[model samples]
Target: MSFLLEFVRDPLTVGAITPSGAALARVATAAVPRTGSPVVVELGPGTGAFTEAIQRRLAGRGLHIAVEVNPRFAQHLGALHPGVDVVTADATDLAAVLARRGISQADVVVSGLPWAAFAEHRQRDVLRAVVAALPPHGVFTTFAYLHSRWLPPARRLLTSLRARFDEVVVSRTEWANVPPALVYYCRRPVTEAP
Candidate 1:
C-alpha cells in the first residue's frame, strides 16, 4: 500500500487513492466470461490489488498472466499472488509477452492502467496490443475514475472503443470507490478485423 501511495503521487499516473474496492473488482471480473481453461491477462496490476480480484474471479480455471512495468511491484505481485505468472513487462507489448509465454490469444483482458494519464497514441497502442491478443468473443474490462463525470476525453475514448469492439458495455459504477469510478466492459467484434 505504501509503495502504491508513493508511486501514485502523480494524479495523472496513479489516478486514485488506494486500489478499487470489492464491488468494482466484482464488476471487472464478471465482465469477462469464465470459459473452461481460458487465458486471462491483467495489465498494470499495481500492488496486486486487481491481481487478487482477478484470481478470485478465475477460480483456478485458466492461465492468468500479470504484466507489470514496475520491477519491484512485479516481484511483490509474484510473492503475493502465488498462482499468477507475474511478468515484468510493458502493457503495450502484450503480443511479444504472450508469444514468449506460448500464448496465442487471450480469452479476457482486464486493465487497471490509468487511461486518463496516457497520451492519445499510448492509449491506441495499448488498445491495439490488447485487441491483437484477444481471440474471438474475448472481453476487455477497464476502469477510469469519475473525477469529472462530464469529461470530453472520456466520452471520446468510449466512442473510439465502440469502433473496435462489438459489445461495448459500461459496467456498474462504483460510487463507493476511493475516487468513484466506472468500469467499461467490451467484447470482441464478430466481424473480421479490417
Candidate 2:
C-alpha cells in the first residue's frame, strides 16, 4: 500500500507521508544486537521497512516478532515478511503478545511507532509496555523526523524516554529517507521492571 493512501486513511497513525526507506531502516536498527539469538519485537512495522534490516541482522537466528495495530498493515507484513510472527494487536499489550509466544521478555525492541502523532498518555502507555517487555540491558530504538525533532510532542517523547532509560543516544541524520530522520537508541539500567 502506498504511504499517501495509508496516511489519508489515518493521518495520526500513519504519521509519515512516505514509508520508511532503506536508510532509515538501517539506522533505526543499528542498536540491536547482531548476535545472541535474542528475541526482538518490532512495533508498527508499516510496509516492513525495519523488518528487512532486522531479518538480515538476525540471519535466521533468534525469534523476531512484530505487533501492528492495523489489520491491513499487519496482513501486509505477514505476507511480505515470511517467517515473521506478525501479531495484529496494539503495542501497549506487549507483555501479553510475548506471553502468547511463551516468551517472558524481549532483548530488543525496534519501534516504527509514530510517537509525535500520539497523545502523551498513549505514548507513555506504549513505552511502559516496551520497558516491561525488555530486560534491564535491553535496547529500544525509534526514530523522529529531523525537522520535527524539536517539536513539542517530539520533545515530550524524548523526556519520557530519558525518564525510563538510563542511557539514550541520538544518531546522526539519515538524509536518504523522505524528510530525513534520526534514530534514538535507549538502554535501561539494572532496575525493576514496570
Candidate 3:
C-alpha cells in the first residue's frame, strides 16, 4: 500500500489507495472482453492487484501483458504473476512493446495507470497508441477516485477520451474503495467517428 501511495503521490495520479480488495478486482476484471484467451494488456499493475484479478478471469487462457514503470513493481509482478508477461516500460510506448511481442491487437486494455497525472501530450500519446493497438470491439477499463476529480480530472481526461475512444461507459462506482472510485469501461466503436 505504501509503495502504491508513493507511486501515485500526485493528486492527478490517484494511485494513493491500493484498492486491492477482492470485490474491487472482480468488478475490474468483469469489465474485460468476453472472448476466451483474448490478448489483454494491463498498465501500471502495481503490486499485481489488478493483475491477480485478470489471471483469475483468464481461467488459464489468454495472454496477459502487464506494463509497469516502477522497477520494484515490475520485479515483484514478474515473480508473482508468472502467467502474465511483465514488461518494464512506459505506457506511452505500448505500441512499440506490443509490436515487439508480435501482438497485432489487444482484446482488452486494463489500466491501473495514473493517466490524469500525465501531461496532455503524454496522455494523448498513450491513449492514441493503445487505441491504435486495439482491435474493433476491444475494451478499455480504468478507475478514478470519485471523491476527487484527480483520477480522470473530468474536464481534461473526459475531452481527450471522447476524442480518442469510440465510446466511454462509466461502470458502477466502487464506493467501498478507500477513497471511493468509479470505473470507466471504454470501447472501440464499430467505426471511427469523423
Question: What pairs collide in candidate 3?
Answer: none
**Candidate 2 residue spans exceeding 4 A from truth:** 189-194
Taking all chains together, each candidate's TM-score versus the true structure is 0.89, 0.96, 0.86
lDDT of 1 by residue, 72-178 (tens): 77887898889999889888889999999888889889988877777777777788888888877888988877775567656656766887798888766788777
- After TM-score superposition, the amount by which residue 113's alpha carbon in candidate 3 deviates from its true location, in angstroms, is 0.7
Model 2: per-residue lDDT, tens digit, 115-149? 99999889988988888888887999999998999
TM-score of model 2 vs. true structure? 0.96
List model 3 lDDT by residue over 1-194, tens digit each: 36655555544444554545566667777766455678899988888878888887788888899998777678988998787899999888888889998878888888887765677777777777778878878888877667666544545776677776778877777877766667777777333432
Q: How far is 58's C-alpha from truth in model 3 (Å)? A: 0.3
- Model 2 lDDT, residue 129, Cα: 88
Report how far residue 29 has shifted in candidate 1, in Å: 0.9
184 Cα displacement, candidate 3 (Å): 0.8
| Minimal lDDT window, size 10, model 2 | 185-194
- Tell me each candidate's RMSD, in Å, in order: 2.2, 1.5, 2.8
Model 1: worst 10 consecutive residues (lDDT sum): 6-15
CA lDDT, every model vs. true structure: 0.78, 0.89, 0.75
User: lDDT for model 3, on a 0 to 1 scale?
Assistant: 0.75
